[model samples]
Target: MKIGLYFGTFNPIHTGHMIIANHLAEHSDLDQVWMVVTPHNPHKQKNTLLDDYHRLEMVHLATKDFPKLQPSDVEFKLPQPNYTVNTLAHLQEKYPQHTFSLIMGEDNLNSLHKWKNYEVILQNHSIYVYPRLASGEIDAQFINHPKIHRIGAPVIEISSTFIRESIKNKKNVVPLLPEKVWHYIDHNLFYKK
Candidate 1:
């Protein structure tokens, strides 16, 4: 089984996230897409994030209906401020039979070189990149690399930070998120600081 790991904070797991994950799952060669919930880095001062469990719950709520999409707390099990290489290693170790790859936007692809052990990651796993309205170009090395596949997926502009700020300002962000996730946020009064 080939699993495309789509990592995100998933503050509320909005429709933009759903579209990308679902599109990759259904359109691409990947058998499934795992929405890896990035847990809050306790050392960071970004108080905007909801608790890790809350974000994980929201991801679960968002992905429950899609059989090809799954919610993963794999990072939560690892130490704080975890790196992608480590997470991929953990997943590989835990599920030895499954083949794991990365699902990232063009924006993230531009910064791939800066990631820890990026060369090792490229050597071991394939990367599926989707289009994004990003400022920088994807790294030249990755442009024609055999391991890198540029997928013709839809570009989603919505951001979780924007949604969180809108909710904090008492704006209606219901349409931006999944129905269950919106309800969960409303019930918990998240981001209404």
Candidate 2:
């Protein structure tokens, strides 16, 4: 089985995450797309994130209906601050029968070189990159890379940052999240100021 690992904080696992995961599963050769919920991303700030277990639960809740979409607590048990390369290594050992690929935004592809042992990741695993607003031109750097492929996924500008701010201000997030996720956020008073 071939698995595409979609790694993120999934602060609340909004609709955008669902859309991409579904798109990947429907369009790609991947057998499954696992939402690898990180306890702490090495490149991002931790203060803005919710509790790791809570974030993981939100992903689990949001993806309950999709059999191809699974929430992974793999990073939770691993060392942190979590690095994608490390998680990939761990997963390879744990699931030797399954071929592991990476599903990420074009933006993340831009920063791949800065990740630990990134060369190894590029050489070994196939990466499916969905387009995102680029901070700069890193595509040119990897244009010749053998393992990277660009995917035609919908461009969703909605982000966890926008969701957090909306919740903080008591604004409607109905359109941005799934109904169950919205209810969970409201019931837990998550991000309430």
Candidate 3:
């Protein structure tokens, strides 16, 4: 099985996340898209994120209807301060029968060189990149790389920050989230601070 790993914090899974994953699952060659819920992102403040299990639950809720879109807690049990290289290596060793690929955005591609053991990643697995509203230029070396595929996914500009802020402000952000996810956030009163 060729699985595309869509890693994220998923503070609260939104419609945009679903749309992108569904597009890749249905239109691309990937057999499934696993929404890997990271415990914490090094780039973002840990305090700003919801509990690991809560976020994972939201992913499960959001993906329940989409068979090809499944949620993953693979990063939850991993050591804190997780790195993609380690995750990839672990996944490979754990699931030798299934090939795993990365699903990232154009912005992330721009900074791929700085990640630990990035060369090892490129050498071992395929990368499915979607467009992002970022200004950083993608390094030239990745332009024609056979391992990196620029999947023509729609430019979903929705931000978790925006959703959090709206929720804190008591705005109607129901449309931005999956119905069950919205209910979960509302019922738990998350991001209301």
Local accuracy of candidate 3 as per-residue lDDT tens digits, 70-188: 99999878886888999999999999999999999899999999999999999999999988877388799999999999888899999999999998888999999999999999899
Q: What lDDT is reached at residue 19 by model 1? A: 98
lDDT of 1 by residue, 107-155 (tens): 8888899999999999999999999987386678989999999898888
Backbone N/Cα/C clashes per model: 0, 0, 0
Q: Report each candidate's C-alpha RMSD, comma-separated, in the order given.
A: 0.9, 1.8, 1.6
Whole-model lDDT, candidate 1? 0.92
Candidate 2: misplaced stretches above 4 Å?
41-46
TM-score of 1: 0.97
Poorly placed runs, candidate 1 (over 4 Å): none
Candidate achieving the largest TM-score: 1
Could you give candidate 2's per-residue lDDT for residues 20-60 as a string of tens digits? 99999989999999999878656676676888888888898
Pairs clashing in candidate 2?
none
Error of 3 at 48 (Å): 2.3
The TM-score obtained by model 2 is: 0.94
